[model samples]
Target chain A: MNLHGTPLSIVIFALFVAAVLFLSFFFARKAKSAAGYYAAGGQIHWAVNGISFAGDYLSAASFLGICGMIATLGYDGFLYSIGYLAGWVVALFVVAEPMKRMGKFTFTDALDAKFDSRGIKLAAAISTLVVSICYLIPQMNGAGSLVEPLLGLPHWVGVILVGAIVIVIVSAAGMTSTTYVQFLKGGLLLIFSTILVGFVLSRGLSTEPVGLESGAPRGEMTVQATDSQLLEQGYALLHTTGSLQKYVRDGTTTWWKREADGTLWRAQWTSDGVVNGVAGGVLEPVGRLRQIGGMSEAEAAAGTGSVGPLDFLAHLTHPETRIEQWQKQAVTDEKGAKYAVYTPKMVSGTDQMKPGVKFKVHTTTEKLNFVSLMMALFFGTAALPHILIRYYTVPSPACARKSTIVAIASIGFFYVLTLFMGLGAAVNGTVNPADNNMSAPLLAMSFGGVLFAIISAIAFATVLGTVAGLIVAASGAVAHDLMDRFGRMDLSDRQKVRAGKIAAFAVGIVAIVLGIVFRGVNVSFLVGWAFAVAASANLPAILMLLFWPRTTAAGIVASIIVGIVSSLGIILTGPEMFAGPYGLTAEQAWHPLGQPGIISIPLSFLALIVVSLVTKNRRVAVEA
Target chain B: MLHGPARSSGPDPASGYKTRLGVVMFIIYCVVYAGFVMTNVVNEGRAMQTIVFAGLNLAVVYGFGLIIFALVLALIYNHLCTRKERELNVTRSEKGAGA
Candidate 1:
């Protein structure tokens, strides 16, 4: 897709940034004390805090990444939605009230509440910093990419700009400004997504592709030719004959499918430089509805106008409905130059509603990987330092519980909308084959330019809100937990708040550098790694501390250290990293599994148990 | 009895009751979530495609059900816990008045 920011988009985005900065400066006076700076003076209303939770938690990954995944891969994307929501069950039920009651400012305070051991303080602080940094990398990188197509800026400029803005937001009024910013972002995101989904349901489905939906004529045609005939025509066959075939000639790669009559029907990429399709006259856009509820192209176009929620889902789930999914192919030309092409594959609606499209459960390793990822996502939320610190932002444990309930309601509602938005992108000719992350925004574009601008601005604000939260968590770790507690700096209240501001600046700079350095890395993958690390390193210790009376200080420390080291070690040495960033073959990696939560989480629990048992004689203050 | 200053010296009486209820709720949710994961794993997601309700497949129904169920459960838990906290505080205040 050729995307250049319209003048209208730039104005809206600038207004959004200005509004956020205004809020920061407005709230600056309220953050005079350390508590005010770190936890918004613990005076946030449960309702506002709840929405802020959604804003803080739903990063660019949830808005762009999941919608993109769902648009491309179907129901497998919703699996992320399910796992992420399930995690809140842990957060609300197990962690929220206890964390609020025990901690004053940071997650480390809660973990070290029972035991005043410096080891616990140091270990928890390190874990917080590690997880916060890992999570920040993806949010920062998402900012850069969102700015590129939304503002027409370069990658580095976007990263630095987001970093500077977030630092100001965090330093100016700390949690007070951050919370309001997130609340605004959350409200706008929900309102706009609901509107977009309403638009989608009203439009319904169409059998015709881009021309009917997007007003762009599709380019496709079928030429009857055998494999040998194609070879005679100077086309080099790349792969063949399942539902799709691939061939490359000159600088263009063409896609083919075998017809029932033993002939090949091909679609070629045009010379428009935007990955448009042009091959004879039968080709269409990369993604569209082929048939809806068994209706043919012309029939469905005339019949299926405007549908309700259940009716829309029912039509999509019909066995006769077929949605065109674009499968991307990475192929090399005759001179070995790499090129990406998309092939249209017609998938049955039933299969589209199933889980096998993206995550395959056929092999033993695949099953383990799927299970591991689910485990990470399910256990990760409560363990995250940013999420944990939010508990302290409320006045009482009951307020924390209420805030969490609100968060679950709003966030859960948003996840449900993602299903419709993703499916809308798929069948409405809005999927960008080159960058799946653009699916939701492009779908808004299909509605209107104004809607697109508003959605893009909300998406960018989503990055800002999440990044501000991360920097706060990292700063709290450095200033409150490590320097104040572990190092016994005995900082005054003013000094502590000033130290936190300085730390926020430092973390923001680091995030900016890392975001630019990892420019092309997938944001979702980085987020998944952060979840694995958080679940492994923090969840076990927190759970045991809350439940197990025999849990000693040494046990918590060991569990955290082991959790961090093991998960990071496995992820760094795993096959995926080896193949992707390390420039080595997957076989060269020592580790087999890509996800670490399955093993590391259990190992962390085991370590805590064994160490606590061994140190039972010297246990720290046991709960009465 | 402790090494350093803490927010409180010992666990409050109400926390024990709340913790028990929270743990039970967590385990209940875990069982259902684990079942969803196992269904996808054991049969290559074939069971997920079975039509369960309202012409929707099991995957969509179950996925949407999980999201809604979480919110419902959270609201229920909050209501129950809030009532319990109020009851305990009222009793404690009454006893203090008598003393």
Candidate 2:
């Protein structure tokens, strides 16, 4: 469902963004001190801070990616939500009060609290930047993806816009502005999502899903020798037009054409008037009913024979169910013809299982890699520099605890509503098969133009809120952790605050550039890497400091370094990164797998213990 | 100074009662965690399985986890609050005697 650029949505979105910016500027005046810039002068109300936690926590990936995944993959997408919420458990029980007590500013404050070690400060700062950048890439990308459809701007322009606005917000008031922005966005996100979910349930499950097409179906045709040797030998001219868009030498391509009336149809490649199969046979476009075993009454009642409500729900929740949807082409030739491929994969069930179901196949095996990725997200929340720093914005540790509980309630309710909204998108048949990021927007389109506009605008605010928070966190690390803490710069409060604002601008620009560069990758997938890195590099250190008596400064420093290196090394050298970008074959990648949480987390813990023990007596004598 | 007063009431039976409560809550948490894991494994990670008691499954799994978390937090807070109360009482009585 393509949005018609409705005036209502534009106005709503404009007002929302303008209000956020205005509020940020208002707060900027109040944030002259370093304390105000980095920690909101320790004056934000617990309730507001709690909601801001939801706002900061629920990024574009959570709202759009997870919702889209649920729309396409079913229960698997919800796994992200569950995993995300579960991480708060770690935050509430293990990290909250202590983090507030230990750290004065950034996550590095807590890590370097016991040691006062420069190594720990530097390592933690670097990890914070890396994870923040990784996390920023997806948010920026989501911003671009959102803008292209909403404002009809180029992807790069969207990235720049989000980057600029977020920088302005961060630079203006730092955490003070960021927190309020987040609180506003978080409240709006929940409120709007609740409204959207209400609309979804009212629509209910239809017998036949209706009105999903938004473009023309063009047939593209391509021919290449099936022989791998021949394909590698030379350039192969492949004819691709109509439904069979392109025949590629190396990869499979797929495409959909929109009819004049906006009825979207899939283009089928045919030989002898039959669709071509891998085995050289005709393939036909199977109607929805035939694909899911002739629709039942539930499907009929919904006026769509494609998929029944129960069946659709079942397919989503079932781990073994393989659902097919169109995805954008990864690589295309110089021709204007876009390439698409049809790939089949099993659904993820990890989202459906409650936390502590770690032993399930979904949680344990490589097939359920997304689950493992989510496990990192779940645990990573407490360790996030941005989030941990937010704890310090409150005056007392008790207030920190109170704020977390409030955040839990707010965040939890929103996640529950996401299920309804996602499932609604699935049955509404308004999903953008090519881009899951547009699921909520498209679902809003199903309701009406105004609803679509409102939801889309709200989603834009979501990006703004999160990006502001991240920029604030990154700025704090640079100005406070690096300069003041390590560099021994004797800057006044005003200078520190000014330096932080400058850092925020620089980080914002970098985020925008990275966002534009990584457009094709799934936002949620990218976020998973961020979570893994955060969990690996930060969680172990935090846990050890809070729980262990023997944790010394040297130990903390060593653990931070080991955790950062091992996680980054594993990710960079892992099959996914090396094979995709580094021009290395999958086999040539050094790591056995992509995820490093399972290994790096443990390694960090061990490194801390061993190093702390070895250096314990040495440190004692020095202090004496 | 804080510990000196707390030492007088430290051996109260209430401590034993609280420990038992802690043990029970811990066991409940373990059971709920195990049951959730078992459900996922047995169902092979399928959704919407009609377990015998209908809504009971959701109630048990979600309720148990939440209750455990809440209980743990409450226990910790209670312990801290009581200690503070005792300290405040001791400090007030000492001031009264000096007056």
Candidate 3:
């Protein structure tokens, strides 16, 4: 990616960061009171708030992960868009006006409104922190991922950079700054992605794919040997009947075979090309076609091994092969250098769809489950804490509602465009085989240098907008919910704002560290966990408190705690976490692979009802 | 009659109409959802898969029937609360008149 020190991109990014900071500081001056800092004094126009909603809601996962998944995996990615949009129905029809009427500062305030219970406040606050942090991890991870390819920096550097920038943005103005940044990013991300999509369609598909070397298979390849010496030295021995040939040393192989000229020859295969018809049977050039039987018309036209232009939509909508070829080697040496290997069955398509091949989404009933999961991700956006907080910045509840509607329109349209952009990347032939996250950026490169630079920069901005909003939400939980509500710090407005700034910095640091730790996990899947947790921990409490008259303060507290703990427990014990990080086997894992919503959400609701029923008459007394 | 805050006395007539409208709309949503679910379950043959997929799509896109349910529940609650408010207001006015 070698994007290091691109003076123009650096200048552009720096200016953008500075502009956001300046806006924050400007808002800071107006944020003289806790209400102003926390809720933008509830005076912002609906249009601005709504666009900011789009900005805050479309996190790195939405832009990078979903787009990348769609590019690589097809229609499954669009399922995320559908799920995300549907979640807004819940937000608009259920949560909006009631939330505005109930809470003054944070989501916690709303839950504890009727009960006035410190226990409820503490529990809700804790849930907010946990969900916020869980959601923040993927955002931070996306930031780090973007930084490397965009600015040519190390992954950790990218993580730290986003963390620092977000803290400053949050500390400077609070919701006000966070709102505008989201507004800017949300608008820019859509516009730029639209532009990128246009470029993709205009470029169209070429009959002859570009950037591929002639005489190589459509997919990547590897070699295996059964001897330690061959394994250590990276050589393979080819045997036919009674004849034997060894390919070894200095990136060249020697093999004997009949040539196309009908002459026997020994040839050496070099990294650049094959020298055939003499020694090792004339290293014949491998054309960009692999013999796969019974391919569809769309598949054939796209390319022998890659997706084509006209069939872009077809490839996206239909199932295709996902091949992962690995060489197995046996080493007998003490240092484990030498090995013998053979090309075991190269797993491709339906074979790769088997469990344990790759992530479950690429290969199981989990694929449809994955679609439902992504739906949760997409719909979960409008209901998020950081997103809802932005509504308070708007002037009236009507504006909040209107802005949300606007957000829906804009976000909805952008998600539609993601389908095209993702398909374009899938067939573009410029994709980094290992990193699907780079699909959009790499697709941009296929067009020209300028488009690539611009898209990459906008992707960077996408991370910034999302991270800033998340940091604000986290800081609010700490300073407003914890410090004031729980700690009972009767601090002045200025002191509270200062405390929030400090909290932002601390949370930002934690985010950066976690981002570095979970480096290679799919951002989209991680996002699913966040949504599951949010739905379980926050959604149940908020929904019940607003609608259920019998919902006691104890119920809210119990629901929040139970929701947070159970969801976290399910996630920690689920296959992805247990097998991957905790070093446990899949079967030994406590729950099924990923569907926590199916269980934890119900449990949270049950806990709230049971607890409330038990303590229906016991109301908390408030001191005057 | 017991005295109370005027705003909390009872439901306005206008509010009652709104509540009825909300309930109607909610019923429409539920009916539509039920139809989709039934069609999905009953249909067979090759077209059955398509129908089932559509049903799944509906469930995913509308959010598992919860949004409609929430709206209906909220409307009912609002209707009850508004009635309570109006009644309280009327009771207070009657008490004052008697005094």
Winner by lDDT: 1
lDDT of 3 by residue, A327-444 (tens): 2222222333332321213233323211222324433435434433543453355446776666567654445556666776677777767767765665554444345566777666
Question: What's the best-to-worst order under lDDT?
Answer: 1, 2, 3
The per-residue C-alpha lDDT of model 1 at residue A515 equals 96
Q: Output the better candidate (2/3) by TM-score.
A: 2
Task: Report how far residue A97 has shifted in candidate 2, in Å.
Answer: 0.9
Which of the two candidates, 2 or 3, achieves a greater DockQ against the reference?
2
Best by DockQ: 1
* lDDT by residue (tens digit), candidate 2, A1-624: 235455677788788889989998999887898778888888888889999999998999889887887666554566666667767766776677666766777888777766677787888898888888878888998898888868878889989999998888888888989999999999989988988877655544443444433341111211122323333655253653432233344454333333344333344433322223344332321112112223355544454333333433443333332233333333243554333433222223323322223223543445344344644765688788878888878876656767887887788777776766776665455555555667788777766777788889889988998888888888888888788777878678789988998899888888988898888764455677778878888888888776577777788777877887887788888878876777678889885567777777788889989998998885422110
* Span of 10 residues, lowest total lDDT, candidate 2 chain A: A216-225
What C-alpha RMSD separates each model from the true structure? Answer: 3.7, 8.9, 9.4
- Backbone clashes for every candidate come to 4, 37, 43
lDDT at position A435, candidate 1 = 69
Highest TM-score against the true fold, candidate: 1
> Whole-model lDDT for model 1 versus the true structure?
0.85
- Local distance difference test, each candidate: 0.85, 0.66, 0.60
